[model samples]
Target: MRIYVLSRQKLLLGLLFLFTVGGILAITQFTLTTPSLVRTPGTYYMANTPEKVVALTFDDGPDPIDTPDILDILKEKEVRATFFVLGKAAQSNPDLLKRLVKEGHEIGNHGFNHDYQQRHLVKEMNQTDQAVYAATGYHTYFYRPPGGFVSKTQLETTNRNGHVVALWSVDSKDWRNPGVKQIVDNVVKNVFPGSIILMHDGGYQRSQTVKSLGPIIDALRARGYRLATLSELKTLDSETK
Candidate 1:
């Protein structure tokens, strides 16, 4: 009887040890995959506001072909948006960047080449900032990492550059060119007050994005939601709060 009791206690202790180690390993894996959640400060997924307003932000943009179509649609609708542009793209199409500022839109840094490794983030950010400023004379205050991948060093570097890291609450997935209707549905269905909607005008085939833009704007406006740039949305966020 004594031997059986000792063996049962040993089994319970071993199981407890395994459970603890497994829990720790699981947490470490989670943090590694979702570093933005653990490392960044003021990383806005969505603004906490009750007002019927949303920020429309585009990434990997200033494309000569698709960007003009997007700007035309926004102009017709009188809706302004923020464009997170790559430095290399901006240098190639300085006029489009200037036109974005002239049309009352905002420009955010998307790094020099949208580097996936997230190396030299600060240098990339500065290069993008200088490019936009040279083209449009507008200084950017927002930086969105490519693919929304954030690291501890990237976060620190971005903050040190005096830029807020912008993330999306509603992703249109338009980059996939997943049918015009699907893209419109993604934004309209997911958008809420103070929500940031992500779309693309540059990387990949964006004809679907351009086609869906007009409808998305109309849908959001029909729902009594005002489309604003990131800077405008930030003001609304503060006011509503």
Candidate 2:
């Protein structure tokens, strides 16, 4: 019957639309932020080097309370890290930002604002890089998109600006305030050679992050991994090569 034929066509169209959306999500889930250009021109972090080196990168912070505590731990540990600080936070907490630089930690840009959803709208990649450099007086060559969200344009533009698009292999999810023990457990369990671990020092109550850092560092070192800032890790890798 004509009615039956129309029903079948409608069902087929609905199925096709669902399939198209699912397919796009599947591809974007992993490859969404990846640049189309296969080659990474200037080296940022070594992808898979065999040294007992790991990079600890903190995003979204420089919070007055948490940032100082995080810095204290890092100072005690005598280890360096990479702080992907937001520009707005940097402007507000100039001393904390300066202290991060003074203490030998490598600083990277995490944009002017911490809006996890705003990728390329407020500030283009060029503007982002300039603002960070102008505020911090350090040329930021590494970028972590806010909230781990990035579009094709953001990734391509960041790469074009000579900044590597940073993604984390280990996420503490400490923002969730998972008990400090759980956060340490998660990080220790997931870390591997060449792993870039993500944590935050700048926003909200990050007491857990500060608490977890010492144990995490001790555990990772006990497991034969040495923590390095991004630049130091890159340098160690380059020296060997």
Candidate 3:
């Protein structure tokens, strides 16, 4: 009977040891992968300044039709905005992508595909970064999930990669073909100093966005707001390690 009891205790102790080891491994893995918590929103920082500086960012772009028009407007205005280009679109429109680079505007990785709920965001991000790097020979440190849906892991991965996840403080919803007047009014009403305004130069039916661009720029400039890219608006200095 004593032998049996000892054997049972030994089994229980072994199980306990295994469980403890597994728990430790899990915790260690999490610690190793989890991004630093210093910046909560992970990637993009909304400018906290009271200065009349706003970022104008376009997503899912370099579309053949709308992008060129938008670029023309930007050039005419002599203002720059961040373009978050999808890998597939960038693959299809290499010249547009190059044009964006030549125009002194900043480019951000919008993923290989526009997957807002991409389960493999980190994996896709690595691939996307590589693809963009290969194409432009320019390394980008900015990312935005499709539709702006991001998980904690996605945020952590981006932050670890020294990339900022750009989010919009104001959306014109030109994607929905909102009236030009409405798009204009929306910006006039919603934009504030340090606002990251969202518009799109790609995706479906962006003609409305193209149409709205001129007036939006005119109105904003008239109001004395300087529209700049995400990089220009948000000052990201190199961390002294």
Best by TM-score: 1
Model 3, 1-241: lDDT tens digits are 3554458889999999999999999988775443221234555636777789888889887789889999999999898889988888887888887788889888988888787577777677777777667767797788887877667887787788767787777778777787998988877898888888888888787878888898998999899998888877776322211
Give all candidates' CA lDDT scores. Answer: 0.88, 0.77, 0.79
Question: Could you arrange the candidates by lDDT from highest to lowest?
Answer: 1, 3, 2
Query: What tens-digit string does per-residue lDDT give for candidate 1 at 1-241?
Result: 3554458889999999999999999999887665334434558667778899999899998899999999999999998999999999999999999899989999999999989786888889999999999998888898899888886677777888899898888889887788999999999998899998889999877999999999999999999999999888888676445
Evaluation by TM-score, superior candidate among 1 and 3: 1
Candidate 3's C-alpha runs over 4 A off are 1-40, 43-45, 236-241
By TM-score, rank the candidates, best first. Answer: 1, 3, 2
Residue 56 lDDT, candidate 2, scale 0-100: 91
User: Which prediction has more favorable lDDT, 1 or 3?
Assistant: 1
Taking all chains together, each candidate's TM-score versus the true structure is 0.83, 0.77, 0.78
Distance from true location, Cα of 226 in model 2, Å: 0.8
Best of the candidates, lDDT: 1
Total backbone collisions for each predicted model: 0, 2, 1
lDDT over C-alpha atoms for residue 178 of model 2: 91
By TM-score, is 2 or 3 better?
3
Worst 10 residues of 3 by lDDT: 31-40
Candidate 3 vs. truth: CA RMSD? 10.6
